[model samples]
Target: MARRRWWELPPAVRGAVEERTGPVRCAEPVATGAVSELVAVLHTATGAHFCKGIRSSNPLAWMHRNEARLNPYLPGVAPRLRWVVERGGWLLLGFERVAGRHPDLAPGSADLARVAGVLSGLASAPAPAVDVRPAAVRWAGWVDPEVVDGDTLAHTDVTARNFLVHAAGVAVVDWSAPCRGAAWIDTALMVVRLVRAGHSPERAEAWTGSVSAWASAPAGALDAFAVARAGLLRERHRGSGAPHLGELADAAEAWMWHRLPL
Candidate 1:
């Protein structure tokens, strides 16, 4: 589970990126994420650009590529993709740097409203014509047996780490997990994170209702998502040693508790 640092990247990979952005004045390795092999910012004459990649042999390399392909369709939600390079057995992707901080999802944080507003816009974004897994297929074992479906492109990973609060607006970064599903799926995903960050089930559900798709979603589908997410999180908590996993599993359970009938 060790991560590759900025200096550890192949000279060819760095050179390939430099071809687009000029010399890397400084390369800062970002230590926040878990999945990707590399995540960092390259300081250049123009400005800082975020970059990340994984080894070609790794099966998840396709995920890095998928983000590059999904960038244009992401519209204003994500930072613009600058360039992508496949070199030295790695897939490198560069994105325009946005000056911002992660939004606070804690109780009473003003950002709750802004983040909901952003999710509402997603109702208007249909899945682009690309070969991507549908949410039902993607979340198969964990979601309802009914295969909850939709045409809107959903940013399945709605964790706080991905929402960048900028002077421009909240830019939802990290499109690594794009799924075609009910537009409301996004609102539900965000509500999970909201509950993780300490929102009560009532408050979290209230925030989700602000989004049209969520407001109109069939009660059965939402109930199914609740149970399925709790089941998935419980399964994850059992396998992982991370302390936070238990807390997250508990949060998902809280949401499930709100949905299930006596």
Candidate 2:
């Protein structure tokens, strides 16, 4: 999908944002990600802050509110939300513009260590006592329901692009798919992407083992997760050229092949 630029927003919406931030001098849109209709760095005389928004009418509009709600409780490693504003049928959020590059989760990359550190911190985060559906309920059709309950807040969409490796540490961004479930769930999600990035299933599992939640996960649960991921990946084959769709499909097959009972 084509990304909308700063100029694309209605004048009323831009004016509303300018009311809080000073006259916008620069609104450079980030050149990646399909989730946001408008995502850019708004530069003022003082400094720059990250901004991303979607129409209030869009189905994913609630994610903006969800991110705002979760930001206070999210681990310190993730960028914090600065403000949330709604105007002219759009919901926008300003974030603590973290400086970083996308993490390289390839098998031999130096950034793998940093990725592990981020996952470890995130594993221990307790879900704020809010009402978000559990992972089991969210992926109920593809996974065993019994193995999905937990209290840890999960960043279930831990694709490689979601993590930014910076000087301070690895920072997670894009809180679009926040879920409350087993902490291992995020690690499991990441493992698939790792495999797609050329890590063997054995190697990916070894990397995941560094995270306590992944190490403590039940064997039965992991088995079910492998099968579930395979099934879900197949279901997501939209026949469109989405990012990493084919590689993930292959990873899914590899995971299921390795974990399925012989």
Candidate 3:
């Protein structure tokens, strides 16, 4: 979807936001992320905060609500939600701005360890009693529903863009797809991303050594997830014809093959 600038927001929507955030001195539009109609850093006299929103008519608009609802439960690993704005057919969420860059997931980057630490921390996050679907149900046809079942909260989208590396630590963003799943699900998802970042499948799996959830996850369950993830990515690539999706699909395929018995 095409991104809308902060100024493009309806006057009513902007007014509703300023009512909470005060007048915006400047707005820096965010260029990353595939979703969201309007995403920008609104700078006010007090401070700058991140705001992302979509028109209520969009089918995925519920994602904004979920992110707002889930942010409270994810303190250290995710940004804090400051306020919400709903006006003129748009629902916007304002978040405490996180100053960070996308993590470098390559073989030797120091950021790798930081990424591992954040994911490991997230592994123990108690599942919030929200309306999120179970991971098994979300991946039902692609993965063995039983293997992905667990009680911890999982940020299903573990892409590099969803993670921000900063002075404090790695903060995971984009909670639109949170789910109830196995504790190691995020780490398992990251393995495919590790391969996409230039690590061979063997080295990528090895990188998980520091993540306790990955170490304790049932091998059979991990294997099931790998295969299903590869298949799912392939289908997505075929449907969207997006180059990055194809690259990730290839990475997932390599990981799936590596997890297969010798």
Q: Give the alpha-carbon lDDT of every model.
A: 0.84, 0.83, 0.90
Clash count for candidate 2 is 0
Query: How accurate locally is residue 212 in candidate 1, as Cα lDDT from 0 to 100?
Result: 79
**Alpha carbon lDDT of residue 28, candidate 3?**
97
For candidate 1, write residues 1-262 as lDDT tens digits. 4689878888888888899999999988887676788889999999999988889889878788888888987868789998998999988889998778889999899998889888899766888888768888988877763546888888888888888888878898889888888878888877788898988999989877678788788888988888888888788888985777778778888998898846
Structural RMSD, model 1: 1.5
| Tens-digit lDDT track of model 3 for 102-141 | 9889999999999999988899777887677899889988
TM-score of 1: 0.94
The candidate 3 region of ten consecutive residues with least summed lDDT is 68-77
Better of 1 and 2 by lDDT: 1
The collision pairs in model 1 are none
Predicted model with the maximum TM-score = 3
Model 2 C-alpha lDDT per residue in residues 1-262, reported as the tens digit of each score: 4567888899999998888787889998797667788889999887788999888998877778888877887778778887788999989899888888998888799998888878888888788787776888888888877777888888887877788888888888987667788878888888888889899888988887678888789989988888888877776765665657767988978977777747
- The list of candidate 1 runs beyond 4 A from truth reads 145-147
Kindly provide the TM-score of model 3 when superposed on the true structure, using C-alpha atoms: 0.97
**Model 2: clashing residue pairs?**
none
